[model samples]
Target: MYGVNTYADTNFASITLDNDVFVGKDNGYTNGLYFSLYNVGVGLRPNFWVSPLLWTMPRGYAENRINVHSIGQTLTTAEDITQANPPEGSLPYSGLLKYTNTHIVVGSRFTDWVSTSVGIVGPAAKGKQTQTEFHALIGAEKPMGWDTQLKNEFVFGFSRGRAIRVLASRSDTMDLLAGGQLSVGTISSGVNAAIMLRLGQNLRDSYPTVSLASSRASNPIAVNNSWFVYAGVSANYVFNQIFTDGNTFRDSRSIDYDHNYNTFMTGITYTIGRDSSLSFAYLSSFSDDDTEYSRQTERLNRFGTLTLVWEF
Candidate 1:
C-alpha cells in the first residue's frame, strides 16, 4: 500500500546460511492475483466511513486465504548492475542476487461485489521485521469493451499501516486509490494509480503513482483434473519511492530528482485445482540516480517471487 513505491521504505531484511545475501525490507516483488485481498480492501470509497447500506444489503463474511512468494536479484549499485562484467569484490555480478518473499492474507467478501481484508507480510525466512495491511474495496463486472465477453471492473480502495516497522500509526497516508480491470476470455489485466494529497512530517507531496499487470490462462492440460497455465507482466512507476531515507548512499526524497523510475515484473501461474493454484515471478527496479543535480536517478538490482493460493 504505502511503501509500494521505492520512496516508501520498510524495515524488513533477511539472510540465510545457505545463501548469505541481503534481502532488503521488501524483495521488490508485486502481486497480481485476481482474488487478491487488495482487489477490495478499501472498496472504492474516497470517503473512509462504511456505508450503512452495506449492512442491510449484504450477508455474512465469505472468507478465503492466500499466500504469495516473490523472488528477484539483490539490490546492487547502479554502476555494478550496469557493468557488463563486475569485478571480483563485486561477486554478485551474476546470479548471487536472490530475494524471496512470502505473504499471507485473509479476506472476506461482504457482498457479491465488495470485500474487506487484512494481512501479515514478511520475508520468506530472514531479514527485517513483519508488517500488516488492511483495506476495503468494491467493484462491478460489466462489459467495458465493444466485445461483450470483455467484462471490465471499476474498483477503488484505501489502505493504511502496511508497514508494521514504519508509521504503524494512522498519522500519515496509505490512504486512497482507484483503477480499472478487465477479464477477457482467457486473459485479465488491470491498471491502478494513486496520489498522496495529505502532507505529513515524514512525507512529501508526490505525483500520481501508476502500475499495470496482465495475465493469460490459456494453456490447458489435464493430469489429475483439468488445469490451465497463464503468464503475465507488470510495471510500477512511482515518484519518490523512499521519501525519507536520509543516508550516506541516499538522502532526502525530492520530486526534482529522487523518485522510483520503474519496477518491471514477469511471471507465470498455474491452476492445479478448482480452489488451489501456484505462481512464480521476478522483479527489477531502475531508480539508480547517484547525483546531486536535479532530475537524476538511482536503481535497485533484481528480485523474484512465488505464490500459493486457496479459496472458497
Candidate 2:
C-alpha cells in the first residue's frame, strides 16, 4: 500500500498463487507460486547497485516507505503439454525462479516503486519436476515434453513505475487511478500503462498494486477496515521475451512471439481486521492486432490469482 501516506511501521508476509486451472486450462503459464515479506527486518544493506535509487527517495510529503523482498516461480509450456514434442510455432516450455527486492514510497496521492530481480530459467529452475509431479498428484495428465524445454540461462531485470490517484467521487467511495511502468532485462523488456476504476469503502487505506500493476499482492497493513472491487485494463509493448524467444545464449525451442497485447481484469478485496486481507482476481489477455503467436495461444492466456496478506 504505497499511497496511504500514514501507514504504520509494521511487518507483513504474503502468499500468492496464480494458475490457469481455475479457468479450465492446463498449458501456457500454467502455474505460479510466490511469497513476500514486507517491511520486515531483512537487513538489506545499501550498496553501489542500489544507492542511487536510495538517494532519489522524495522527502517531506513522502509519509511512508517500505522494503519488500519476494521469491517466486512461474511455469509456461506449449499448448499441448502431454506431447513428447509439441508442434511448431507454439509456446515453448520454460520455468523461472526469481528473487526481487522493491523499494516503495507513498506520498500525498502518488505511489512509486523501483525493483530489481535475479532469476534463472530452464532445468535449473525445476519447472519440469514441479509441473509433472504436481500433475501426478492431482491425477492430471502429465507434461511429457519438458525435456525439450528452454536451455538454462541466468536473467537480471529492473523495473520502475508510479501510480497516482487521478480522480475521486465526492463520497470518496469511487476512484480512478492510472500509471505507467518500464522494464528491461534478459528475461524480458517492455513498457506498459494501466487505468483502474475502483468502488468501495476506505479507498485511501491502501493503493491498487495487485491486478493494476501486475504485482502479486495488495498492502497487508491497513489504517482501518476496508474493501473494494476493481476493474482495470493495461496495454503493453514488449521488446523481447525470453520464454518465447528461446534461450538467451543458445538455440532452443522458440516462437515468433507477439510484441503487443492488452490485458483486462476484475477482482475484489476484503480486509479482515486491520492487519489482513484476501484477494481474488481473474484476468485475460489478447493481442492488439492478430498475430500468429497470439492466435495460437489465445485460449491459454486467461488465469486467476488468489493472494493472502497478513501481519507478521
* Top-lDDT candidate index: 2
Residue 192 CA displacement from its true place in model 2, Å: 0.5
lDDT, candidate 1, 1-312, per-residue tens: 211222222122111111102223221121111222222122222111213223422333223211222232212111222244333222111111221112212122111221122121112211111111201121212111111111121222211111111121264323222222222111111222322112222221111111212111011111112222222222334222221111113221112333334444444444456444454544444445545321223223244445444333
Badly placed stretches (over 4 Å) of model 2 are 1-7, 40-60, 208-223, 296-301
Question: lDDT score of model 1?
Answer: 0.23
TM-score of 1: 0.29
Clashes of each: 45, 0
Error of 1 at 104 (Å): 18
Worst 10 residues of 2 by lDDT: 40-49
lDDT per residue (tens digit) for residues 1-312 in model 2:
323534546777788888999788887878888998877222323333444455554555555666777888889988888789988887899999998778776665787777777889999999999998998999999899998899889998877788888998877789898888888888778899988888887776566343223444332222347778888888888898787888888999888866778888788887787677788888888876676767543544578888888776
Q: In candidate 1, where is summed lDDT lowest over 10 consecutive residues?
A: 142-151
Positional deviation of 62 in candidate 2, in angstroms?
1.2
Model 1: CA > 4 A from native: 1-237, 242-260, 287-301
All predictions: root-mean-square deviation over Cα?
20.7, 3.0
